[model samples]
Each structure stands twice: as structure tokens, then as C-alpha cells.
Target: MLSWVVTFLIIALIAGVLGFGGIAGASVEIAKAIFFIAVILFLVSAVVGLVRGRSNI
Candidate 1:
């Protein structure tokens, strides 16, 4: 999932360089959304792990 953010970022950069304003803007927005979702999922997983008494967490 995090890799998707990197992929979108690369696409945005390339699109911007190639003068594709709309594609670049949309890719950037998608990347930002994916990043936030990944962070939220990580936090939720950590909390769940802790609640389950997992020392590795």
C-alpha cells in the first residue's frame, strides 16, 4: 500500500515534467490520500497488537 504512494509520486513527477497538469495534480492527491490511509492502518494495527498483549508491538 505504501508502495502505491511512491508509485503515484513518481508518476506525478513524470507527468508534471511532461506538462500534464491534470494528471500530475490528480496523482499527487491520490498519493496524499494513500499515505494517510497507510498511517491510519498502521496505528490501528499497533493499538490492536498492544491490546492483545503482544510484546512485539
Candidate 2:
């Protein structure tokens, strides 16, 4: 998921350099959304793991 966000970011940069304003904007937005989603999922998983570990003790 994080890799995808990075991929899109690179694509956006390239597109912007190539003078594709619309494509670059859309790609950037997509990258941002994916990055946030990945971060949220990571946090949720970490919390779940910590809670489960405590319960096991």
C-alpha cells in the first residue's frame, strides 16, 4: 500500500514535468489518499497487537 502511494507520487511528478497538469493533480490526490489509508491501517494493526499481547500476559 505504501509502495503504491510512492509509485503514484513518482508518476505525478513525472506527469507534472511533462506538462500534464490534470493527470498530475489527480495522481497526487490519489497518492495522498492511499498514504493516509496505509497510515491508519498501520496504526490500527499496531494497537490491536498491543492489546492482544497484554491480554496474553
Candidate 3:
């Protein structure tokens, strides 16, 4: 999931460099949304692990 965000970020960078403004903007937005979701999920998982006494984390 984090890989997807990085992929979209790279795509946005390339699209912006190639002058595709609309594509770049859309990709950037997608990247931001995915990044936030990933962060939220990570935090939730961390909390759950702590509460459950999961040491593997």
C-alpha cells in the first residue's frame, strides 16, 4: 500500500515534468489520499498490537 503511494508520487512527478497538468494534479491527489490512509492504518495497527501485547511488532 505504501508502495502504491510512492508509485503514484513518482508518476505525478513525471507527469508534471512532461507538462500533463491535469494528470499530474490527479495523481498527486491520489498519492496524498493513499499516503494518509496508509498512515492511519499503520497507526491503528500499532495501537492494536500494543494493546494486544504483540511483541513481533
Candidate 4:
């Protein structure tokens, strides 16, 4: 979910600011992975919509 991606990203930023190196790193990695998955899902949804004869797509 895009919201999850933003949440993890904010967590990473706050942890980094608070000097938590390991937590910051892990959070950033998780955020990156979630963002990628969200993007992939969006693209797949777009393609599927187009194929299904959706005019809005």
C-alpha cells in the first residue's frame, strides 16, 4: 500500500534523526521494497484495466 510506504519512510527519517543507525537502515530497506511492490501492482492494474475495455483507463 502507498500509505505503508509513506509510513515506513517517515519512520526511517525519524529514526535516522534520532541516531538509530540499524533501525533507520532496516526501515529504509522495508520502505524501498514496499514502494517497488506498490508501483508494480499499479502498473499491472493499469494494464489489466486497459485490456478489459475500460474507457477511463
Candidate 5:
């Protein structure tokens, strides 16, 4: 999921450099959304791990 954010960010950068405003804007929005989702998932997983007392983590 984080990888997807990175991929979209790279696409946004490339599109912006090529002057494709619409694609760049859409990619940036997608990247932001994916990044937030990844962060939320990570936080939820961490909370779950701590609550369950997973030593491996």
C-alpha cells in the first residue's frame, strides 16, 4: 500500500514535468489518499499488536 503511494507520487512528478496537469493532479490526489490509508492501517495494526502483546513486533 505504501508502495502504491510512492508509485503514484512518481507518476505525478513525471506528469507534472511533462505538463500533463490533469494526470498530475489526479495522481497526486490518489497518492495522498493511499498514503493516508496506509498510515491508518499501520496505526491500527500497531494498536492491535500492542493490545495482543505480540513480542515479535
Candidate 6:
């Protein structure tokens, strides 16, 4: 997921350099959304793991 975000960011940079304004804007937005989603999922998973580990003790 994080890799995908990075890929999109790179694509946006390339598109912008190539003078593709619309494509660059869209790709940047997609990258931001994916990055946030990945962060949220990571935090959720970490919290779940901590809760489960505590229960086992």
C-alpha cells in the first residue's frame, strides 16, 4: 500500500515534468489518499495487536 503511494507520487512528479497538469494533479491526490489510508490501517493494526497481546498476558 505504501509502495503504491510512492509509485503514484513518482508518477505525478514525472507527469508534472512532462507538462501534464491534470494527470499530475490527479496522481498527487491519489498518492495522498493512499498514504493516509495506509497510515490509518497501520495504526489500527498496531492497536489491535497491543490489545490482543495484553489479553494473552
Q: Using alpha carbons, what is the TM-score of model 4?
A: 0.87
* Candidate 6 lDDT score at position 31: 96
What is candidate 2's lDDT per residue for 1-57, written digit by digit as tens?
Answer: 989999999999999999999999999999999999999999999999988786534
- Point out where model 2 deviates above 4 Å: 54-57
Two-way lDDT contest, 4 vs 6, winner: 6
Model 5, position 3, has a per-residue lDDT of: 89
TM-scores for every candidate against the unseen true structure:
0.91, 0.90, 0.87, 0.87, 0.88, 0.90
Tens-place lDDT digits, model 3, residues 1-57: 989999999999999999999999999999999999999999999999889894665
lDDT of 4 by residue, 1-57 (tens): 989989998999999999998999999999999999989999999999889874654
Number of the top lDDT candidate: 1
Provide the lDDT at 13 for model 6.
96
Weakest 10 consecutive residues of candidate 2 by summed lDDT: 48-57
What is the Cα-based lDDT of residue 7 in candidate 1? 100
Model 1 clash pairs are none
lDDT of 5 by residue, 1-57 (tens): 888999999999999999999999999999999999889999999999889894755
How many residue-pair clashes does candidate 3 contain?
Answer: 0
Local distance difference test values of all predictions, in order: 0.97, 0.95, 0.94, 0.92, 0.94, 0.95
- RMSD in order of candidates: 2.9, 1.9, 3.0, 2.9, 2.7, 1.9
Q: Give lDDT for model 4.
A: 0.92
> In angstroms, how far off is 16's CA in candidate 6?
0.4
